[model samples]
Target: MSEYRVLVVEDSPTMRQLIVFALKRIRNLQIEEAGDGVGGLKKLSAHKFDLVVTDINMPIMDGLKLVSLIRNDPQYKDVPVVVITTEGAIEDRDRALALGANEYITKPIQTARILEVAKKMLGV
Candidate 1:
C-alpha cells in the first residue's frame, strides 16, 4: 500500500487522540499531531502532509487562520484541509469553506464520519 501522511491539529489532547485513533485505522497512513495552529504550520514547513484535520478553537492561532495561511502558501495551497470544530453555524461553515477548507465537520463528531471523510479526502 502507498504511504500517506496526515496532520491532526487540536488543542485538546483527548480530541487529538480520538482523531489520531480514527485515522490509524487506515492502512499505510502516517499520522502527526500538533497542539495548535502554529505547531501545525511548523509541521507543514518541515514535511508535506496529504491531509490536514484541524479544530478551530485552538490557542496561539485558530484553524481559520491556519486555513488562510495554507491557502496563501503556494507550496501548501493545493493540500486538502478538513476543519473539525464545535462551530456549527452556517456562517462558520461558510467562512471555513471560503478560507479554502475542503471539508468542514462539526464537533460531537462520529469517528466513523471522520474516518469516512478522511478516506474520501485522501482517496484511500
Candidate 2:
C-alpha cells in the first residue's frame, strides 16, 4: 500500500515534534513539517497530502488563512485540515470551522485524540 501523507504546520519546533510523535502511531505515514503557514502553503502546493495538522497562530501566515486558502483552491478544497491551537476561545474555533477546517484541537493535547481523528480522516 502507498503511504499516506500528513502535513504539520506549527511555529514551535517542540509542538511539531510532539504532533509527529502522536501521529506516528499510525503506520506507513510520510509526515512533512512546516514552520509556519507560508511554508505550509508552499509544501501544500508542491505535494498531494491526505491530511494537514496546523496551529492557528504563527508568523507570516496563520491557520485561518491556510484553511481558507485550502478551501478556495480546488485542488485542496476537499483535503481535511485539523487546526491545533493554544487558544481555547469559541470565536477561534468558529472561525476555523467557517474557514473550512475539518477539526479544531486545542493545546494541552491528548495524543490519542489526534490519532483517532487522523484515522477517521484518512479512513485508515
TM-score of each prediction: 0.95, 0.95
**lDDT per residue (tens digit) for residues 23-108 in model 2:** 99999999999999999999998999999999998899988899999999999999999998666577877899988899978888
lDDT of each: 0.92, 0.91
Error of 1 at 95 (Å): 0.6
Q: Against the true structure, candidate 1 has what lDDT?
A: 0.92
* Deviation in Å, model 1, residue 63 alpha carbon: 0.2
Please give the TM-score that candidate 2 achieves against the real structure: 0.95
lDDT of 1 by residue, 93-115 (tens): 78889999999888898899889
- Model 1 is weakest, by summed lDDT over 10 consecutive residues, at 85-94
Query: What lDDT score is found at residue 3 in candidate 1?
Result: 91
Candidate number of the best lDDT: 1
lDDT of 2: 0.91
